[model samples]
Target: MLYRYGSLIHRRARLVLVIAVLLIAGAAVAGAGVFGRLQGGGFDDPGSESSKAQRLIDERFGGRANLVLLAHATGGSVDAPDAAAAGRDLAAALQREPGVRDVVSYWSAGVPDLRSADGADAIVLAHVDGDATQRRERAGQLIERYAADGPALHVRAGGETAVNLDVNGQVARSLAIAEAIAVPLTLLLLILVFGSVVSALLPLAIGGIAIAGTFAELTALGAVTDVSVFAINLTTALGLGLGIDYALLMVTRFREELGEDRPVAEALATTVATAGRTILFAAGTVATALTALLVFPLYFLRSFAYAGIGVVVIAALGALVVAPALLAVLGRRVNAWPVGRRRASRSAGTAFWARLAGAVMRRPALAALPVVLGLLVVASPLRHVAFGTPDEGVLRPGSAGRQVADRLATGFPSNQNASVDIVLTGPVDRDRLAAYAQQLSTLDDAALVTSSAGTFGHGTRAGEGNPALSRPTGERLTVASRLTAKSDAAQRLVRSIRSAPAPAEAYVGGVDAALIDTTHAIGARLPLGIAIVVLATFVLLFLFTGSVIQPLRALVLNVLGLSAIMGALVWIFQDGHLASWLRFTPRPMDTAMTVLMFVIVFGLSMDYEVFIIGRIAELHGQGMPTDEAVRTGLGRTGRIVSAAAALLAVSFFAFGTGTVSFLQMFGIGCGLAIVVDATLIRGVLVPAILRGLGRLNWYSPAPLRRLHATVALREA
Candidate 1:
């Protein structure tokens, strides 16, 4: 099948090139539309309880959303007239902004109202009827407008508006820095691995086109579906990584064929037949793994899964069709730099691999025991792994959000708290509501509270007809409590409130609230993701190798690799044991990140597995014995596998250099896993096991054997 494709593409190189160009152009045009829709309306649907609450608010409250800003004097009393006046001026200035709907401040509260109910701080609330991006910009302008007069009143803007603006800037900067490192480092690694500037550059160009196209498609899709900002980075990374990997495999095969005395068209055909088919299978596996994320209850995971799958599809097509077409045009030049001594035939039984396998088989217990023990020892730390959401402090210290969050943590609570909604079944007495509200003020973790009844009361209130009655029926009261902490602390507080056995049914909802629900959802569905990936791998390998045991062996080895990687990660980040050397400030791992790592690492590890198995299968077809085939195949593909793994590791590690600790942990963990997988698992362990098994590597049930022979298992 691939031979015909390569032949046709070679014969009509210009036509094939035109098609490639058109596909990319179409994708570009479509991506612009996707971007436009995304800019107009962002998708915030994660389907978590917190998101459900936010949705409820959006549905129940139809007016423009108001962002409250508090500008307090750092060195002066917030009660001073000047401080009060500055707050009023800033509020008025915000009111004049293009998107501003209204402003609420002490000055707007009529005559002589200059202090908050607490009498310690003044407040300014700005209302904006706009998208999140516009709201953030308006907040930025407010900061600039009040800058000169701020210090005189010790004015520091701290509110949802300020925090959102700061967080947006931080996310943008982190992405920019991650990409800045990822791109150049990717190119350098390609150049080294391909040993040719042109080949290295080729994949980047193809990947760039794919990304542009994917973005265009995503933008178009955004018109119908919500595309988060995070999707952009996901698409870029997926497109680039897969693009390079696919093209390199084909190019390597094409070069080898040419060296073996095949003509340009024939070499292209062979390359397509072999490497192209393999690329398809590899991408199919990756896409399948990513698609499992759609089962997640959160839109965040679903969005990532879809975008990643799109990139992988585009990358696979580029390598299978576009790359071969391009190769046909520059066939000989693709391998202009000749590698010496091309060996056409491999022996039936190789000495080194045979001996190595014998050694492993002879000491199977010794060899397997030590490796398994080592992995377990590394994995031990995960028993104590604590999960938490990332804080702004994980960003660079110079970041505005980090500085603000740090200040807030010091002055307020630990930064993990949420704005809660406490609803009552029936409410009639304003004084009783006020009494319950006063109790909220006395809670140890409550740094601040905002309520409809003016002030919160102390201690729990219990009465038959009280607004604090614990019921989920009509006529409810709501209170928004800003807690001191962010992730776990907020989660604990929410649990505490719900578990208090109080009369009123309380519902806490915020980012922390959303994360808690999302984390629970992730834990519930994570096993499904593993099962999906494993099932897909089994099917792919069973068809490719015609052996059940071989597939099972690969699965076992992959599990070991994952355990080792995760164990090491828990040891470093969870335990805070390696904070000094790695320059990492340990924070709890986001639940989503941990699950993401499992999918990504497993899919990537499959790349090496497939590559090795393909080479072995090829040699076996040429009549090499099982032992000789394993050795010879390893020798042939080892360099490429090692180089590819190294390049992938370097690309991932580049992300670690960014200010986001989550990205850093991801990079380091995956990077370390790849190094271990390529060397320890694929290189040492698999060979040792295969040596013991001998012809068992080819063993399969008669029915399966017949099916495998029918399929032919030709990847390219």
Candidate 2:
């Protein structure tokens, strides 16, 4: 089947090239506006109780204020006549902005929560009304207008909306920085690997085309759904990494076939038949693994699935379709501009990989023991792993949103923005609601609670005249508690309030409650996502290798490699070991990022495994002994896998230069995993295990073998 497709593509190489160029041009045009349409955050599960409560609060009571302008009295106290006048003027000016609503300030509202603890500063709170994109756009404009120093007061913009805007800006900047570093570094490394300028440039060209196509797909996806801006990072990294991976494999195979003096058509056919099949299975594994993320309710994760799957599909097409056309057209000219040394003759059987594989096969147990033990030792830090959601802390230090968050954390009496909102449905009993609010305020974690009766502090009613605290619309009344979002204290407080008695059916909502519910949602569905990825991978590998054990082995090794990577992430990012060097404040690893890394790394590990083991299986089918097949296959494919892994690692490592902690974690973790997988797992352990397994590596039940045979992936 691959040969037939290759023939058809080669026969119409010029036409295929024209079509590929035109498609890329169209994709570039369609994708030009994607960044502006992407969302900054989608970490909440809309179906959860917290989400419902939030919806009720928005529809019934006024929606939450997501923008805060901090006003600092530079010359005197904010209550001083001049500073107070400036604060009021700024508040009134913000209220006039098109998208700004629910504006409140200490000078206008006389609310103590709006006043800073020291009295020298005050907050102007407002709601940025619109969808995610609109809110961010407005927040940007507001920051430009309001975040400036005046004679009496210095104003700075912040809050959830401001944080979103900052995050969007950072993502865009990081994408540019990562691409800048990745492109040139990747080209240099590819030149070193291929030792030919033409060969090196082909993979980058394919990668560029794949990225353009992926951006177009993401733009379309963003219009209909809440696609996260972070997905662009994934799209760029995966597009380049996988595009180069597939191209490298195909190009290397084509070069080898040509070295054997085969005609251009025959070499292209042979290359596609072997490497093309592997690329198909590899792409399938990656797409299936990423598809498991769809089980997550958070679009933050699901967005990656969308981007990853799209890039994998596009990268594969570039390799199988566009790359083959290019190779057929270039022929031996692909090797022009050779660098350093002429391409070495692999038939000499003196390659370093063959010798290394032979040594491992001769002492399988000795070779494998240290590699396994070393991986376990490196993975030990996972025992202390903690999970949390990203917040303003994810922003770089000294950023506008980070500055506001730091000030809020230190200067405010309590974070009203992080307050947990308890919604009561069904009946309005003022006394019962007041009693519930009192109970909430009495909890050690709760600083205060507000309800229709009044605001209560530590179970005592502080005041009762605030109209915003009273619900005049319907049976629903909101009781808000002062608790930090995504904190352990806040999580405990949410649970306590949910369990506390109330006059009606109560649902808790706020940043804290949303995070708690999101955590649960992930835990609830994680097992199913893992099951889908594992089962699908098992089936795919079974069809590819006609063996059950090989798939299981692949799973085990991939897990070990990924576990070590996760452990390193926890040690460096979560444990704060490299906080200064990485330039990120340490916190728990983002739960969604952890899951994303696992699925993505597992699938990519399988990708390299398929390439290595498929060749081994082919050689074994050609009457070579198991040990010999392992050595020969490793010798032939080892350099390709190493070069591909290096290119992929470079792509991810570029993200390490990013400012966001989560993106840094992703960049460093995946880059380390690729390096470790290619070296320790693929180089030493896999060869040793194959030697130990011997004939058992191909063992399968008769019924399963028949099923596998029916669907077996042919290797030329």
Candidate 3:
């Protein structure tokens, strides 16, 4: 396979180069027109409990989803006529702004009920179209324009739209900070591994091209749909990860041949045939894992699924196709600045992996027990993991969004600006509805209740069952109530409300309720996604390795790594341990994080599976004894695995510097898992199992044995 493909590619180098270039160009052209307004179907407008509360108001009052709440007080008497006059002026100016569909201050018609009895503090709510980004910019302009007015009103914006905008800003800046660190560090690591500056740069170049192409595509897609900023960061990270990984595999193979004294063209051909083929399988596995996310009901998960697929495919193309062409052209120049080259006479087959495998074989049970126990210990924290939506605290505590959120929580219901809506039927008068609303308000969990008559206090909205509810029109009445807390508390409140005996023929739905439903929906579906990835991985690996047991072994080890990592994240973030030291606040993991973790861990685990299995398979194909093959294979691949793991770990570690809680958790979890998987599971336990199983490692039923001979992988 190697000689034939290498000869063909070398003979048609020009044609291969031309074809690769054209493919890349075509992808780039197709991706170029994607802009913010023309986004792909994957992007969605980020919705939260706060946004849902605002939506309740929109549905009830015919207003917009965006709101702007202003705090007004003069130096001395806030109740003075002048102060009130100034507040009204500020409100009027806001109402005049473009896209300001409507605005209501204390003076607005039918709004005096919102004012404090003493009139010392007041707020203005505005309705607007578009996303939080546009609305937030408008809010800032409003604040800046109103801050210097007479008597100096302290105007601060607090609402779902505003907070969403603020969070978006923080996320964007944090990604910039992370990229600034990870990209350069990745390049440096690649350079160090490859020896020459040029060789090291190959990964960066390919990754950069792939990312550029993806972003351009995303931009065009954004024009027609919403694209979360987080997707951008995710795409970049994945592209870099896979690009460097593929380049490393190919370069390592190329160096091995050079050491064997093969001609440059022959070495390039062999590297492409062997390493290139392995990359394809590795990429196939990763893409398969990522594609599983599409099965998730949420649009957010599907978007990332596509993003992951795109990045992995592009990286594989760079490695399997472009890399060989470049090597063919460069020839001996590829080693012009060889840095980590081992002496030609000393084979990687002589590395410490053989000794480690021997030790593991001698104590298979003991060796496997400790790694499993260690992972279990690390995984203990996962039991304490609590799920919640991302909050303002996920951003820097000092950020505008954080400040505003704090103010709302402290001065109003803990779940102020967040509510659940219930629509009831039958002939109910204002008094009955008011009594019902009041009853809801008095519930231990309710915060501030209100209705058509007036607000109970903060976030509680009293229901106004006017003649509308009894009329033949069958008017829809929405009951809104804010909880005293976010996350679990809010979810509980929604559950209690749903379970309560309300009027007959009533339907309940709000942001909190929706989130609760979403959470449950995703949680229920997780097992399905896991089963798909695990089952498919087994079938694929079973076929690839011709071993019935190896695939199961891989699945068990990967699960151990994942569980251990999740537990550590739970202890570190959910429990708030070491959060201060890391300059972050611990918050519950959101649905998105859980889904993402499953996908990323599965894909990453496959990289190790293929690398280790490829080496073992190669030795077996050469007719080596099972024990000798396992030992030699471990020895040959250990350093490369270690190096690759280290590079990925460092890159992930860089993300810990981010302010976002999920990103920080991701950084630590992935970094720690990679270390454990590379050093312990792969290095120690895999060898033990292979040794204990002996010939079973290569065993396949007669029916499948033929398939292995034909479709089974040949070593790259």
Candidate 4:
């Protein structure tokens, strides 16, 4: 199949190139509007009870406050005439804002929960009415207009909309900075690796097509469904990285074929036939791994699936169709413009990787034992892994939302800003509702519980609460915890609230509730997600290699490499190692980001794994011994793998410059994973393991062998 495709490219190279150009041009034009179409947050499970609770609140009550304005008396008590006047003025202005409603503040209701313990700072709660995109836009506008130090009240913004806005904004800026650092460095490194200016340009062109095409896909998907804007970062990073990966393989083989003195047409056809098959298989593996994200309900993970599959498929197409055409056209000039030397990939059997493989094969057990133990130790931090959703704390210390969140944590007696909201859906019994509120009030961390009946303090009815809690069909209850919402205590309190007997059909939601629901949602599907990735990857590798043992070997090493990366992330990001240098708060890893990083690293590690194993498989099929095939394959392909991994690592590493902690963790983790995979896993473990397995590496049952011979994906 690939041979025919390659033959067509050889015959109609110009036509293919022209078509690719037209498509890329069309993609760029359509993709320009993607940012506007994309949204800020899809971290919540839309079908979860917390989500239903939020929707019920919006439909019945005005809606739980999705916006918070933390106000401080500049020089005196908030109840002072001047400070009280300024607080009321601020609330009135917010009440009149176009997207704002349900303005509740200390001065407006004289609510003790709205005022800080010290009586010097207070909070204003308002519901921002919109979808994620609209809410963020509205919040940005409102914060810009109202969140500043005034004559009497100094206000800062922190809430769902504000935190999402801050995260999305930081991601955009981080991507820009990452690109600024990565692109030039990648180009220069490509030139050095390719040893020619002309060869280096092909990968960039392919990357461009992948990115533009995926952006166009995102634009279309965004218009109809929920798509996170964060996917843009993945589109850019993975698109370029995969482009370089595929192009490096194809161009290296093309040059190797041409160096055999074959004509351009024959060489191009062979390169396409071999490398094209490899590219397709690699894309399938990556797309399969990324497809595991589809099982997740959160559009944050699903959006990455959309972008990842798009980029991988498009990159593969670019490599198979566009790269071959370009290689055919350029032919001898593909190796043109040598920088300092005309050095290209050599078939010399004495390369450093070849010697390393030889040494390892001589003592596979000795080489394998220590590296295994080291990765296991590094991955020991896995036991301490914990997860939470992204919050304002993801931003740097001085970020506006973080400032508000910090004050909410320390300045207030209890953070009313992080209330656990419950909504009754059926006809309400005021008696049962009051009883429920009293029950909620007794929760270990509950500070206050407000409902239509009244406010409960320590299981006792205090006084009349916000009148807004009452509605015709149902009632709304807000429970404020003394502990911060991200805390274990807060999670426990939320769980207790949900378990407590309710007056009617109740849905519990808020920061703490949403966190519990999100954790549960992701946790429930996590085993299935892992199963899909693992089972599919195992099958794909089996089909490619026609050997069960090979797939098992791949899985073990891939896990080892990824385990170390995860441990490093937990240690550095979660445990606060190097927190000062990175300028990010130490907290639990973002559940969604951690999953995204795992699949990305897993897919990409398999990408290199397939390359190395494919080369060895080919050499062994040519009648070489296992040890000779391993040495020769590593010698031939090591430089390309190193170069590609370095460029890819640099691409991800640049994101470490961001102010957002999760993204920074993601950047550092991915870069570290690549370096470790390339050097340690690919460099040391693979060779040692292969040596240990020997002929067992290619073993398959007779029936399966026959099946593979009939339908297997062919080696390059």
Question: Across residues 1-716, which tens digit of lDDT does each residue of candidate 4 receive?
Answer: 67777878989999998988999999999999998889887889999999998888888787778788988898768998999999899999999988789998899988777788888889998999988788888999999999898888888888878888888888889999999999899999888777789999999888888999999999999999989998998998899899888998999899889989999988988888777877878898999999999999999999999999999999999999899999989989998888865453343322878988889889888988999999999999989899999888889989878888888887787786577888887667777888888988988888888988889989998888667888887788988866876798888888888888887888898877888889899999999999999999998888888899988898988888899889989999999998999888899989999999999999999998888888888889889999999998888777778888998899899999988888888889989999999888888899998888889989999999998899986753
Look at candidate 3 and tell me the lDDT of residue 302: 68
Regions of candidate 4 where Cα sits further than 4 Å from its true position: 344-350
Error of 4 at 537 (Å): 1.3
Q: Between candidates 3 and 4, which one is better according to lDDT?
A: 4
Error of 3 at 467 (Å): 11
Model 1 agreement with the true structure over 1-716: per-residue lDDT tens digits = 77788788889988988977887888787776553344311223356555655554444432223454545565455656766676667777777777765466655653122243434445554556555556667668766665444543544454455555654554557667867888898888776666677667777776786688778767766667655555665676667777777787888788778878989988988888888777777887778888787777655566678687888888888888788888888877764543332222212113444455456656666777788788889888777777765445455556544554455444432232245544443433556555656665466555433344453434443222322222223223333344545545566666655554434444445656655676677788888888999999888888877788888998898888898899898878777687776666677776666777788788888878888888887788789987778777777666667766776676677666655666668778878988998777877788778777878887899988888889855654
Could you give the candidate ranking by TM-score, starting with the highest?
4, 2, 3, 1
* TM-score quality measure for candidate 3: 0.88
Residue 640's lDDT in candidate 2: 85
How displaced is residue 671 in candidate 3, in Å? Answer: 2.5
User: Weakest 10 consecutive residues, lDDT, candidate 3?
Assistant: 36-45
Residue pairs with backbone atoms closer than 3 Å in model 4 (clashes): none
Q: How many backbone clashes does every candidate have?
A: 32, 0, 30, 0
Candidate 2 residue runs with Cα over 4 Å from true position:
344-350, 472-484
- After superposition, candidate 1 runs with Cα above 4 Å error: 29-45, 59-75, 95-129, 140-151, 154-168, 337-370, 390-393, 413-417, 423-454, 460-483, 487-489, 499-507, 577-585, 710-716
- List model 3 lDDT by residue over 1-716, tens digit each: 75577667766777788887787777677665443332212222235333343444455444433565656576553446776777777778877888776677765543443444455556677776555346556656655565343554676665656666665565667677878888888877776666677677766767766676676666665666555556665677777777778877887788788878999888888888777777877888888888778766666676677677778888887776677777777776776765665343135434667788888888999998988898899899877677765656677677655665565554442334555565554445555656565556655566554444344533344333333223331223333344433557767777766676654455555556666756766777788888889877877787667877788888888888888888888888888888888877777776677778777877888887888788788788889988888888888777778777877777677778887777777777777877888889888989888888887777778888887778875664
Question: lDDT: which is higher, 1 or 2?
Answer: 2
